[model samples]
Target: MKAVWLAVGLLVASAASAQDYAESDGAMLRFLDKLTSVTGDVTLSRGQAAQFGRLVVRLDSCRYPVGNPASDASAHLTILDDATQTDLFNGWMLASSPALSALDHPRYDVWVLSCILPEAATEAVEGE
Candidate 1:
Protein backbone atom coordinates (compact mmCIF):
# COMPACT_ATOMS: atom_id res chain seq x y z
CA MET A 1 0.00 0.00 0.00
CA LYS A 2 2.76 2.45 0.84
CA ALA A 3 4.56 1.71 -2.44
CA VAL A 4 1.41 2.29 -4.41
CA TRP A 5 0.84 5.59 -2.69
CA LEU A 6 4.38 6.70 -3.43
CA ALA A 7 4.01 5.84 -7.13
CA VAL A 8 0.75 7.74 -7.35
CA GLY A 9 2.29 10.77 -5.74
CA LEU A 10 5.14 10.75 -8.22
CA LEU A 11 2.75 10.55 -11.16
CA VAL A 12 0.72 13.46 -9.93
CA ALA A 13 3.84 15.58 -9.45
CA SER A 14 5.03 14.74 -12.95
CA ALA A 15 1.73 15.74 -14.52
CA ALA A 16 1.61 19.01 -12.64
CA SER A 17 5.12 19.86 -13.75
CA ALA A 18 4.25 19.15 -17.37
CA GLN A 19 1.19 21.36 -17.25
CA ASP A 20 3.22 24.21 -15.78
CA TYR A 21 5.80 23.83 -18.49
CA ALA A 22 3.17 23.96 -21.21
CA GLU A 23 1.65 27.13 -19.84
CA SER A 24 5.04 28.82 -19.68
CA ASP A 25 5.96 27.89 -23.25
CA GLY A 26 2.61 29.18 -24.49
CA ALA A 27 3.31 32.57 -22.95
CA MET A 28 6.67 32.82 -24.72
CA LEU A 29 5.11 32.03 -28.08
CA ARG A 30 2.52 34.73 -27.56
CA PHE A 31 5.25 37.27 -26.76
CA LEU A 32 7.17 36.28 -29.87
CA ASP A 33 4.11 36.79 -32.00
CA LYS A 34 3.66 40.27 -30.62
CA LEU A 35 7.33 41.18 -31.12
CA THR A 36 7.40 39.89 -34.69
CA SER A 37 4.39 42.01 -35.59
CA VAL A 38 5.96 45.17 -34.21
CA THR A 39 9.53 44.63 -35.43
CA GLY A 40 11.09 43.89 -38.80
CA ASP A 41 14.07 41.70 -39.79
CA VAL A 42 13.45 38.84 -37.42
CA THR A 43 16.53 36.67 -37.07
CA LEU A 44 16.78 33.18 -35.54
CA SER A 45 19.87 31.24 -34.51
CA ARG A 46 19.91 27.49 -33.97
CA GLY A 47 22.55 25.64 -32.00
CA GLN A 48 24.00 22.19 -32.61
CA ALA A 49 21.45 20.57 -30.38
CA ALA A 50 17.68 20.85 -30.77
CA GLN A 51 17.45 22.85 -27.55
CA PHE A 52 19.95 25.58 -28.42
CA GLY A 53 19.72 28.94 -30.23
CA ARG A 54 18.42 32.47 -29.74
CA LEU A 55 15.52 34.34 -31.35
CA VAL A 56 16.34 38.01 -31.95
CA VAL A 57 13.80 40.56 -33.17
CA ARG A 58 14.84 44.09 -34.09
CA LEU A 59 12.38 46.68 -32.78
CA ASP A 60 14.30 49.87 -33.59
CA SER A 61 12.01 50.73 -36.47
CA CYS A 62 8.82 50.78 -34.39
CA ARG A 63 7.03 54.09 -34.73
CA TYR A 64 4.32 55.85 -32.77
CA PRO A 65 2.35 59.08 -33.05
CA VAL A 66 4.42 62.28 -33.18
CA GLY A 67 2.96 63.68 -29.96
CA ASN A 68 2.91 60.29 -28.34
CA PRO A 69 6.01 58.59 -26.98
CA ALA A 70 8.33 56.61 -29.27
CA SER A 71 10.60 53.75 -28.28
CA ASP A 72 13.05 51.15 -29.51
CA ALA A 73 12.72 47.53 -28.45
CA SER A 74 14.66 44.27 -28.75
CA ALA A 75 13.78 40.76 -27.70
CA HIS A 76 16.24 38.00 -26.83
CA LEU A 77 14.54 34.63 -26.56
CA THR A 78 16.43 31.64 -25.20
CA ILE A 79 15.13 28.10 -24.83
CA LEU A 80 16.61 25.29 -22.78
CA ASP A 81 15.84 21.59 -22.34
CA ASP A 82 15.15 21.87 -18.63
CA ALA A 83 11.62 21.89 -17.30
CA THR A 84 12.24 24.04 -14.22
CA GLN A 85 13.94 26.97 -15.97
CA THR A 86 10.71 28.56 -17.23
CA ASP A 87 11.99 28.28 -20.84
CA LEU A 88 13.00 31.93 -20.78
CA PHE A 89 12.12 34.26 -23.67
CA ASN A 90 13.19 37.80 -22.85
CA GLY A 91 12.35 41.18 -24.48
CA TRP A 92 13.89 44.61 -23.93
CA MET A 93 12.12 47.83 -24.93
CA LEU A 94 13.65 51.30 -24.71
CA ALA A 95 11.99 54.68 -25.08
CA SER A 96 13.94 57.83 -25.84
CA SER A 97 13.36 61.38 -24.66
CA PRO A 98 12.01 64.23 -26.79
CA ALA A 99 14.90 65.07 -29.10
CA LEU A 100 15.64 65.46 -32.79
CA SER A 101 16.70 61.82 -32.89
CA ALA A 102 14.80 60.60 -29.90
CA LEU A 103 14.17 57.37 -31.69
CA ASP A 104 17.92 56.87 -31.80
CA HIS A 105 18.10 57.01 -28.02
CA PRO A 106 15.98 55.26 -25.45
CA ARG A 107 14.66 56.84 -22.26
CA TYR A 108 13.03 53.78 -20.75
CA ASP A 109 13.73 50.11 -21.33
CA VAL A 110 11.66 47.06 -20.48
CA TRP A 111 12.57 43.39 -20.34
CA VAL A 112 10.31 40.35 -20.14
CA LEU A 113 11.00 36.63 -20.08
CA SER A 114 8.43 33.83 -20.20
CA CYS A 115 8.80 30.14 -19.54
CA ILE A 116 8.56 27.33 -22.08
CA LEU A 117 5.42 25.24 -22.18
CA PRO A 118 4.71 21.93 -23.94
CA GLU A 119 3.00 23.53 -26.95
CA ALA A 120 5.96 25.81 -27.71
CA ALA A 121 8.53 23.10 -27.09
CA THR A 122 7.51 21.15 -30.15
CA GLU A 123 7.54 24.15 -32.47
CA ALA A 124 10.63 25.57 -34.13
CA VAL A 125 11.65 28.52 -31.95
CA GLU A 126 14.62 29.65 -34.06
CA GLY A 127 14.87 30.21 -37.82
CA GLU A 128 11.90 30.42 -40.15
Candidate 2:
Protein backbone atom coordinates (compact mmCIF):
# COMPACT_ATOMS: atom_id res chain seq x y z
CA MET A 1 0.00 0.00 0.00
CA LYS A 2 2.78 2.41 0.86
CA ALA A 3 4.57 1.70 -2.38
CA VAL A 4 1.41 2.25 -4.41
CA TRP A 5 0.71 5.54 -2.69
CA LEU A 6 4.32 6.67 -3.20
CA ALA A 7 4.09 5.88 -6.88
CA VAL A 8 0.84 7.80 -7.21
CA GLY A 9 2.32 10.76 -5.38
CA LEU A 10 5.38 10.75 -7.63
CA LEU A 11 3.21 10.66 -10.72
CA VAL A 12 1.07 13.53 -9.55
CA ALA A 13 4.14 15.58 -8.58
CA SER A 14 5.74 15.01 -11.95
CA ALA A 15 2.57 15.88 -13.86
CA ALA A 16 2.00 19.04 -11.85
CA SER A 17 5.63 20.17 -12.04
CA ALA A 18 5.80 19.79 -15.81
CA GLN A 19 3.03 22.25 -16.49
CA ASP A 20 3.50 26.01 -16.63
CA TYR A 21 0.27 27.82 -15.87
CA ALA A 22 -1.04 31.30 -16.45
CA GLU A 23 -3.42 33.12 -14.14
CA SER A 24 -6.78 33.80 -15.72
CA ASP A 25 -8.90 36.79 -14.88
CA GLY A 26 -12.04 34.75 -14.71
CA ALA A 27 -13.86 31.60 -15.72
CA MET A 28 -17.02 30.50 -17.49
CA LEU A 29 -19.16 28.34 -15.27
CA ARG A 30 -22.30 26.34 -15.77
CA PHE A 31 -25.04 25.78 -13.27
CA LEU A 32 -27.70 23.13 -13.45
CA ASP A 33 -30.82 22.48 -11.45
CA LYS A 34 -31.22 18.75 -11.32
CA LEU A 35 -34.85 18.82 -10.32
CA THR A 36 -35.93 21.16 -13.06
CA SER A 37 -33.34 20.08 -15.58
CA VAL A 38 -32.58 23.72 -16.18
CA THR A 39 -29.09 25.02 -16.87
CA GLY A 40 -27.44 28.37 -17.18
CA ASP A 41 -23.99 29.74 -17.91
CA VAL A 42 -22.23 32.59 -16.23
CA THR A 43 -18.83 34.22 -16.46
CA LEU A 44 -17.23 35.23 -13.20
CA SER A 45 -14.11 37.24 -12.51
CA ARG A 46 -11.83 36.61 -9.62
CA GLY A 47 -13.44 37.68 -6.32
CA GLN A 48 -16.81 37.92 -8.02
CA ALA A 49 -19.79 36.10 -6.66
CA ALA A 50 -22.99 34.87 -8.27
CA GLN A 51 -26.17 33.30 -7.06
CA PHE A 52 -27.47 30.11 -8.58
CA GLY A 53 -30.63 28.70 -7.10
CA ARG A 54 -30.03 29.08 -3.36
CA LEU A 55 -26.28 28.67 -3.62
CA VAL A 56 -23.81 31.52 -3.61
CA VAL A 57 -20.70 30.75 -5.60
CA ARG A 58 -17.58 32.85 -5.51
CA LEU A 59 -14.62 32.53 -7.77
CA ASP A 60 -11.37 33.07 -5.97
CA SER A 61 -8.96 32.39 -8.86
CA CYS A 62 -8.70 30.71 -12.23
CA ARG A 63 -5.72 29.30 -14.11
CA TYR A 64 -4.82 27.44 -17.28
CA PRO A 65 -1.82 26.20 -19.18
CA VAL A 66 0.36 29.17 -20.16
CA GLY A 67 0.41 28.70 -23.93
CA ASN A 68 -2.36 26.16 -24.23
CA PRO A 69 -5.47 27.68 -22.80
CA ALA A 70 -7.74 25.08 -24.38
CA SER A 71 -5.83 22.22 -22.86
CA ASP A 72 -7.21 22.48 -19.35
CA ALA A 73 -8.67 24.82 -16.75
CA SER A 74 -8.74 24.99 -12.95
CA ALA A 75 -10.48 27.38 -10.63
CA HIS A 76 -10.60 28.02 -6.92
CA LEU A 77 -14.12 28.40 -5.61
CA THR A 78 -16.01 29.12 -2.43
CA ILE A 79 -19.60 28.05 -2.33
CA LEU A 80 -22.21 28.56 0.35
CA ASP A 81 -25.85 27.74 0.79
CA ASP A 82 -27.55 31.00 1.50
CA ALA A 83 -30.73 29.43 2.80
CA THR A 84 -28.98 27.13 5.19
CA GLN A 85 -26.09 29.52 5.81
CA THR A 86 -23.67 26.64 5.45
CA ASP A 87 -20.61 26.04 3.39
CA LEU A 88 -21.28 23.55 0.61
CA PHE A 89 -17.84 23.49 -0.91
CA ASN A 90 -14.53 25.33 -1.04
CA GLY A 91 -11.82 23.94 -3.26
CA TRP A 92 -10.29 23.81 -6.70
CA MET A 93 -12.40 22.48 -9.56
CA LEU A 94 -10.85 21.20 -12.77
CA ALA A 95 -12.57 21.61 -16.09
CA SER A 96 -11.02 18.47 -17.46
CA SER A 97 -12.17 16.39 -14.51
CA PRO A 98 -14.93 18.13 -12.61
CA ALA A 99 -16.00 14.94 -10.89
CA LEU A 100 -12.64 14.73 -9.19
CA SER A 101 -13.47 17.91 -7.29
CA ALA A 102 -17.10 18.84 -7.52
CA LEU A 103 -19.64 20.89 -5.63
CA ASP A 104 -21.77 18.49 -3.67
CA HIS A 105 -25.34 19.76 -3.77
CA PRO A 106 -28.61 17.90 -3.80
CA ARG A 107 -30.46 20.03 -6.32
CA TYR A 108 -27.77 22.04 -8.03
CA ASP A 109 -24.86 20.92 -10.13
CA VAL A 110 -22.09 23.37 -10.92
CA TRP A 111 -18.94 22.95 -12.98
CA VAL A 112 -16.27 25.03 -14.68
CA LEU A 113 -16.47 25.27 -18.45
CA SER A 114 -13.32 27.21 -19.26
CA CYS A 115 -11.04 29.98 -18.15
CA ILE A 116 -11.36 33.56 -19.35
CA LEU A 117 -7.82 34.43 -20.31
CA PRO A 118 -6.09 37.76 -19.87
CA GLU A 119 -6.44 40.42 -22.54
CA ALA A 120 -3.11 39.66 -24.15
CA ALA A 121 -3.72 35.95 -24.31
CA THR A 122 -7.23 36.46 -25.52
CA GLU A 123 -6.02 38.71 -28.31
CA ALA A 124 -3.35 36.23 -29.30
CA VAL A 125 -5.84 33.42 -29.47
CA GLU A 126 -8.30 35.49 -31.43
CA GLY A 127 -5.67 36.67 -33.86
CA GLU A 128 -4.68 33.12 -34.56
lDDT of 2 by residue, 4-92 (tens): 99999999999886577888889999999999999999999999999988989999999998777777999999999999979999999
Residue 121 of model 2, lDDT score: 78
Q: What is the C-alpha lDDT of each candidate?
A: 0.29, 0.92
Question: Over the stretch 12-44, how does candidate 1's per-residue lDDT look in tens digits?
Answer: 999875443111111121222242334222222
The clash numbers for all candidates, in the given order, read 9, 0
TM-score of each model, in listed order: 0.22, 0.83
Best by TM-score: 2
lDDT of 1: 0.29
